[model samples]
Target chain A: MQTVIDAHNISKVYNPDTIPVHAVNSVHLHLNRGEFTALVGPSGSGKTTLLNIIGGLDAPTEGQVVINGINISELKPNQLINFRLHNIGFVFQAFNLIPVLTASENVEFIMLLQKRPKAERTRRVHELLASVGLSDKLNVRPSQLSGGQQQRVAVARALASRPQFILADEPTANLDSHSAATLLDIMEKMNREEAITFLFSTHDQRVIDRARRVITLVDGRIENDSAATQIRH
Target chain B: MLLKLAWRNIWRNRNRSLITMSAIASAVLLAVATVSLQQGVWEHLIKNLVSLYTGYAQVHAKGYWDEQTLENSFEIDKTVEQQVAGTPGVNAIAHRLESFALASSGDKTRGCLVVGINPAEEENLTRLSAKIQSGSMLESGQDGALVAEGLAEKLNLALGDTLVLLTQGYYGSTAAMKTPIRGLLHFGSPELNNQIAYIPIQLAQYWLDAPDRATSLVVGLEQAEDLPAVARSLKKSLPKTYEALTWKEMMPEINQHIEADSAGMYIMLGVLYMLISFGIFSTLLMMLAERQREFGMLNALGMQPWSIARVVLAETVFLTLCGSLAGLLLSYPLVWYLAENPIQLGGDMAEIYEKFGFEAIFPATVKAKIFVEQTLVVLSVGLVLAVYPVWRVLRLNAVEAMRN
Candidate 1:
């Protein structure tokens, strides 16, 4: 029942060439503390735009975004960076892992950004990689790992900071179906067990089926919000 | 952790790092070495000039220094020597007599400056004894005179040859003294080489009709910088009638010459710094551009804009310190090896240097100040040049950077 992310009539207009384009229009959503929500829309339907605003990566033209009792619109750049470092973790469609870092190093990176102690970061990295089934690939770079393994590392990284909210923008878009399903299972398990909120922007049925609550987006507006009671347990 | 990340990141593009370092090192090498050599040559030239002409400083009757004439002259005695030697920082003091005299040898006569000095004390102040190539310096007060080498050659004289000296001595007194040419000595400057002559202080006093009197006391010191301080102390310590002057104050023409030379060097150093600064700034600019995506992600990952600037500055500081020290170190042996065996300037340069009376060999001697000054200049300029990229990185938009 706890609202982790609350939006009020948020709209984003971008000026690409001195002419305004409505990227997202009059959108509203609320994510509970333990919710796994899916935002289903076609390409360019402003799914990423809404996700970016909620993640505090962007500012909308005419609305306020509130997360964890603080309105992000009120924060300056440095405060915003502090908020992101302490309270948010992100996993992107292409993995977005720094290619130069190894598997565990990529996961340990968030802990580093937090300026956590080295020994604690190492231990946490070990535990997270193990949890993601990548204990053996800890020292392997992204090029040396499979798609599913790299995505798992990203997932571990997203969970590294132990944030109340996680944002995944088409995380499984580049994975094989088997890898996709496997990753979805890991995300769902983390969502339910740890009470970590997750919001994914996906058109894939696999990702949609794995969500407890699904919101269908069309042309930058949410058309429907539905909940399914298909707990596979 | 910051240092660790910075170090590791530098090694990622080894070629780029090497190029940047090499640019810095070569810059330091050229600038520092050039400065060290120029300073060395300047010291050598001043040493020779001071030894040959006015000693390091002089003490004369008040108003006599500003206007050199017979009217302002004073007598020399044990009291003057005792007073000058009693002053602090006065290494040596010798009595001297100077007059404009006409010298005639078989009707070929020229106007010349005739100097009278105590042979023993003058030896401590100037290299007058060693400059005597043809005959002995006046060892005994009874006999012999030291004439200019060029003048002696023009007069067709050798050791023990006598020349007639005619002059209006002190108080409009007409006097003449038959003197034997004891030796011939060369001066550092061409004009002095042509027309100056030296004699025993008593003998010159006798010829000038002011027997036991001198025009001034030539004083010498251990170092050039000590000259002004000693001059000040002498001014306060000595009688009110006498004044003290350093070589720089006494010789305004030479001071102006050196000042003009150094001003030109300043303009040249500005050019060199611009070249090096551009080299460093260009390399850093390219590096920032190449690593745009990485910097964007670092910002996204919670590294603040200030932290990014610190990282870049750290890179430049490290590079500047290492390169400057390495260049200075390597240049030591290079310059020492070169100074010990100088490079000869052949053809036109050889002819030119010889014509100007400078040595044909270009030798470089290192000074501790040259190293410190050149290093400070390069580091400060490089840091200033670093401002461009640091500002660019701080103002860079994160999303646009990620797309870069």
Candidate 2:
């Protein structure tokens, strides 16, 4: 399997010289193509921090985070932004849909920034929103949509750029059982049908149960990996 | 899409947006109105002053401005007339022969400026015929003299009264004459009114024994703005013996006076603009605070800081444009109304204006530059205030910004 991400000895130290707090200490990890993996840990266990570094939203104090054979730590700010636009997608726990944009416009924003053709953007927006069961809510603003529906629109937005992988930080933490289950079903179907990789950080047991592989962290270090689901699907 | 998002975002907090827009609009409207009135008053004062005696420009013997005497008067030859006439902006030229003379009627004797003019040309240039307070305008080839109202009052002379004028003429010649007061001309300026007397040019030449000679040619232009250009052209074409001077050169005191007065107005405008900038900045700061998480999400989603800044700037520009355009549209009718029917001054202000020989009224000018300049100034304030929010976005830390 092609390696999508290769992070080696990544350490993030806050206030290194005085009362240093090791947020993520010398953590090594790899995520291969076509894999649905979860980074599970308790609150403040550096799962979100590691995900942030892997997604290039942050920089580590030591070592490098390599995504698709390019060391993102070495890239300039502008280059990293361009790389992320082309290759990475993000889903915040809050379903951070732009309040002003309609559901479809939220999804279309990434492609717009990517400078995609207008026809292709329109086609993909329709297909993606329809696939996420938000076709009826395409013209609705985030304030007018339910939490579950808004999250689904966020998912569609993450997929609009056709990135190498999607980083979902606590994707189902805020949802109830039914909505979480429904969101999982859509994400599972997309992963299985389109072979799009998904990396999520969650403490939810339900989210852990569905992931093919899970890496559990404690005290900013990985404590367990489910050996039975080590192979990429 | 960027513009659409910006537009929608502003309307999301409609009340806040409206407040900001109102602030900008009010500032622009007030600024436009204030400048319009200032320019109107200044133009009116300048027109009154220029037409009082000196036209928009004057052509005199090179040394005549320094020494007002019959020896410095130049002959109105064909070359000089043609050169002055060929100048593009020169609408009309009124020739004058000016000298100091003592007038006595019965008991009172006063020194006054005696000006000889071609009645028809003078009337065309300065509208001298319209200034007649009592009696009739001076006719061409009339042997009568027109005394200014103040001068006539001082000399205690009425219409058709014999006023004696005694003065030295060309080449040390003693000039003495008696003529009837043909008209009493009203002068806005007390000094000019107290010291001016007009007689026909031919009669003046005959009395002074200076044939075909005039002290200066007062040149009027179609528009006041053309005064400088016409003066420059005339100066270039005129002989070294002649000097063409615009009203600005002829009246440095007025320029200095305007400059001194404008310093205070500019300070007031500066304070107004500062308040306007603060109003806009407060709105931006509030909006930014409200949308911290949204900006963070955008930042995390691979949207460049520059892109986010562009969106914020777009919002600012939209608001600024809306406010400025509305203000500009609203100002036209308001200015027009004020200009058509000026605000009359009363009380002490009216007394002061009258003392300066000006009408006591506030009028607004309906000029394109007032609108364009005020719009630019207000828009620039918006753009300048936008920098604070743009800087906030440029340095945004997504993790921290998203925390709340």
How accurately is candidate 2 docked according to DockQ?
0.73
- Candidate maximizing TM-score: 2
DockQ of every model listed? 0.42, 0.73
State the TM-score for model 1: 0.86
Model 1: residues with Cα > 4 Å off, grouped in runs: A16-18, A93-113, A125-160, A172-193, A202-209, A227-233, B76-90, B102-111, B130-137, B140-142, B181-192, B227-240, B343-361
**Second chain TM-score per prediction?**
0.89, 0.93
Residue A48 Cα positional deviation in candidate 1, in Å, after optimal superposition: 2.4
Query: What is the lDDT, from 0 to 100, of the residue B210 in candidate 2?
Result: 92
Query: Clashes in each model (backbone N, CA, C under 3 Å)?
Result: 0, 0
lDDT of 2 at B315: 94
